[model samples]
Target: MPIRRGSDIGSPARTRSRKKSRRLWTAGAIALSLPLGLTAAAQGNASSPFGDEPELLQYEEQFLTLYETIKDPANGYFSDEGIPYHSVETLIVEAPDHGHQTTSEAYSYLIWLEAQYGQVTGDWQPFNDSWALMEEWMIPSADEQPSNSFYDPSSPATYAPESTDPADYPAQMDPDVPVGEDPLADELSSTYGTDEIYGMHWLQDVDDTYGYGSACGGTAGDPTFINTFQRGPQESTWETVTHPSCDDFSFGGENGYLDLFTGDASYAQQWRYTNAPDADARAVQAAYWANQWASEQGNAAAVAGTVEKAAQMGDYLRYSMYDKYFKEIGDCVGPSECAAGSGKSSNHQLMSWYYAWGGALDTSAGWAWRIGASYAHFGYQNPMAAYVLSTDEALIPQSPSAGEDWGNSLDRMIEFYTWLQSAEGGIAGGATNSWEGDYGTPPAGTPTFYGMYYDEKPVYHDPPSNRWFGMQAWSMQRLAEYYYVSGDERVGPVLDKWADWVVGEVTIGEGGDFQIPAELEWSGAPDTWDPANPGDNAGLHVEVTAHSQDVGVTGSLANALSFYAAASGDTAAQETASGLLDALLANQDAQGIAVPETRGDYSRFGDEVYIPEGWSGTMPNGDVIEPGSTFSSIRSFYQEDENWPQVEAYLNGGDAPTFEYHRFWAQADIAIALATYTQLFGAEE
Candidate 1:
């Protein structure tokens, strides 16, 4: 994701992730090492649309494994779509991990996967199962239900009290809610080990959820059933995946895709078609699409296209998004070190997360290419995943002031992308606001504090300019989704790695609320902060009471995990997705946010909040999922407003989005989630 102002400038010297075995390129290098392109017809073959290479098999197996973990079963509710699912009740209390299920993430990815391989084999049991749980429980409903997700413990369901000091470290489970009487206090588990163990446990929950063999009971009232979250996968997510120039194409057109009038072949062609069917290709293309749309599609065009696309796709919430793509890196993965611009942190992520999608704005992100890579795969309310991914890149430059340098890869700006999460599923670095402590010493500005609160109580807090669990929301999820749709190779590991981190942080205790071990604290110390100051932001703080950083992260990982399991055939990812699905379902509001239109099984979640306003923003199509407004202003996310209906409506796919503020405020990083998530979890979500 782009920096939150005051970070290093330009790109940071990245850590190399390759070897030195390939033959050296002679002065006359013919770009010969690349593989041959697959024909359009052959591209979608059953043997992996990307083709017969060894890597395809590897990814396929991985996908299968993840799928197995999350696929629906026969023991619980089933969706007419033939997907299996478990009830939030059992999913939460019985499951020992993965309480933070990402509702919106699951739906978007399932739609894309079905679009791609439906005919050959289109049973999204994995996605469906996960979706069922999320829909049933995770979202905050008017019924005042509580999700197993620790992020927002029980705003509506139980109505427990929340915290007022997000800055406090080493939090107890119930900062506000009375412990013994709390609704989920008994079912929620505890996070009592190294952050890694906590994450692994959550991962285990995801595994178990998918392993359940019961199919979702029905799909009758599923709110987003008819919404075209993804386009026909038969066609390349871009214009022409197999086209050689695709490396340069920027998905654009009257369709939810992209077509920069300048006509760069599908910049994503290089991405997805590096054979469009490949994961790497998809990741790269998604980034290209996102960048192109934002840069070339003027605001008026963007607004019209977004609203029209939402209508066409059958979802009022599926607006426009920054694709999280770029033209420079077309279809190839970055070398151990990324290309100058391809890997260079762009500012669009910060500004775009909150402003796109008419009045629907929210964001996601893992790190770096957050907005530039994941919008399509993760930013779906409709079939325009590719377009939203593209839009992510366009909104960077306008983020709130005092932002960090896009490329700087440490502390405030660069930390979260490649870094790990804390015991409570919290991320670290300088997000939220800048100025306090080292955060306040930006090259040109001061930092502000942005911590999470739950049930009206504080969970984690960072010093001014210091963010511990902060991330680029919309962008992070979008990048992961892009990896799946565009078929980018790096998509696999990227998604996996990040998921691992988030899993360690978000988990349920034996009591069922959520937990964060004290050992995971890496805040305000020499190891955490720079030595010059001997101080950093607060430790990695994740809580279940109010808004937790994991709300953005856990959801993104789960969504990607579901998809990757589908693509690579990985059971682990599948299981993880299932656990997340269940948790999210238990926490959701039946008719709020993403209300199931029909009502069988499955419901989308999240509230609408513009970028630059809150810590996280909505998807690229401009649907606000998270809360926003003035990062440092405690009142921003602290107040209890009457936007509940808006949140539900948007989550279930808004019918009337007001895209008047597609101007992401530098900090909202939702636009860049996919790329970031993909960079970590492999192809899962």
Candidate 2:
């Protein structure tokens, strides 16, 4: 029998495993240096579409390890409840040494992956597991909240709640305040050290419940608003509050976690709110498709449930769409300072995260300035969700905001693409919102929040203004889908423009020097932000330079271009897409190493700081490399000395970082793109 890792249970490709080898690019230059051995296709005469079935299966198994790693076998669910999960179960302690909680974005990724896994193999376990997670832990408790009745986590099969009563959850309330005060305002004040805004008694829960509270309280059925009686006369002597239902992600609160002071003297406070459009969008997509999968399995309830769940999220996402920023120094500022205009205007602009407290936004009133919007991703699935919800009117309870027409979704996409398309014919990676934090003074014409105790004067870094091919490629894929679905005449030209953009950006050189510059800089960057003050944009303007192509960006482009070509009947686009695919295949490891290149996995592990003026190091080819040194005044490499040797060797060999280190996200991006490519165009070249 051939060597097996786990669950290998004899595969036909196993017989030819010994013969498999890959041709690696030589260390010196981009040229192919030496012949290693036979490729996977040559070794097994593989018949699977994407590449080798066994190899892909192995990669899948390896990728699933992270999920397993984060799982709590004892608890029978994922670990890490606080600061991440909104489970009312008190025994569910945070997983030891585990990664960050997969609340907002990871939920969608897992949903998408589960569907893909089920499609490939005749197994619904992954899909079932993913759905169970969404049903059990992700969706907020809706027992008390009528507005959040769309996705109820009341099923006994998947979720076993320790306490069903709303009064059972552990929370504190103030006795002096009235009973009907706003829970959201009180919660925000208590959490962020602000004045108690509401006169009604506030139920203060832990961080885990913030997202749930934001969802439940922001919406109508405030399940998290536990009704408590006063136990004592003093203000702090109110009875403990407990949630009637588990509410998480039911209402869209973009902030993921609290921004605690890290003791960094230069920064007063830094609050980062993660709003991954790609993750959230894909989750919606998964829900739309998962319903179809469920229907195929003869689960009508699941079919309806999935669509309703997706619609709920889609509704929440609408609140997060581009809205006017409050300009009254602390009010909703529209037309002039909408969050959409503050960032680069991608047609469907979706930000992964919005950082506040660092002077990124005008937060003089408080750090919780609610300006909703995110940077855009190409494969936004909100449109699909809208279509599904609109078509299946009876299955899901329609909200005026949630049940918006498909036209609304299309317009969002149009807006994103409009903002994303650059003058350079490439789509930027969205705007970088960085301001220097030194200047305590606010800029002229801006409202000042100087006296607020909890609100700290924030300084931002030099704003990121550049285009990323990876993001552009992903956007192209979404555009292609939109065109295919709507056949909108306007989208056709935009699609063609993006196709041409890809052709210009993606460069295939001599001896398989296939590469795409990772990023292109903005036209102008102010050189010096007020470094003297340290809290404001002093006067720093740095332009971004390009970096080498990686598998993720290339894979996305390959898939998008393939879609565009097929949709438009553009032969040139088709040819370019084919070449890109061929290049990707050429780069694949025959030995079945799933080490897809990512930009930043190994570089983060450095204990020793390697800060240089210009070039970090030289390649074996006698060529100096400066990866994004233009904007960066000083180069810094935080590398662990012991691990540097191995990492350096991998880099020299033009190999990607190790899989175990960057599993969830980096793994998913490439896997999803490639799977999508295969789905779009079968192996028949």
Identify the leading candidate in terms of lDDT: 2
State the lDDT of candidate 1 residue by residue for 1-685, as single tens digits: 1111110110100011121122211111112222222222223334332236532223333333333322334322224443322222221211111121212223333323322221112232322343344333322122111112222212211111112222221112221221111121112223111110000000111212221111112122332110100111111111111111111111112211212111222212111100011111122223233233223323233223322222222110111111122212211122212112222221222211111100000112111111111111111111123333223333222222111222111122122222223333333332321111111122322222211000000112212111222232333444444444545453455456555554455554221133222212333211232324433334434342323323324444555554454444455555455344333323322211111122111121221112212233222223332233221121122113243344346446755322111111110111122222222233211
Residue 330 in model 1: lDDT: 19
lDDT of each: 0.24, 0.34
Q: Which residue ranges in model 1 land beyond 4 Å of their true spot?
A: 1-58, 61-102, 115-520, 524-685
Count the clashes in each prediction. 337, 67
**What's the TM for model 2?**
0.49
Provide the lowest-lDDT 10-residue window in model 2.
1-10
Q: Per-residue alpha-carbon lDDT of model 2 for 1-685, expressed as tens digits? A: 0000001000000000111221121111112221233223323534323455443333333333323332324422233331222221221111100122233444555677666554444355566566665555444332221221111111101100111121222112111211111112232333334331111111223332222344323443222222111111110101111121222312211111110101111222111122334445566666655565455546546446555655554543442343112111122222223222222121122222221111112134222222222222233334444444445553232444334434455554454444444444454333212111111233333311111111111111111222344445555665665454445566676677667766766666433357765654543212121223322222212232675646556656665775565556666665555455445444444221133334343332222222122324321121222333211111112132233455566546645444323223333444554454344433221
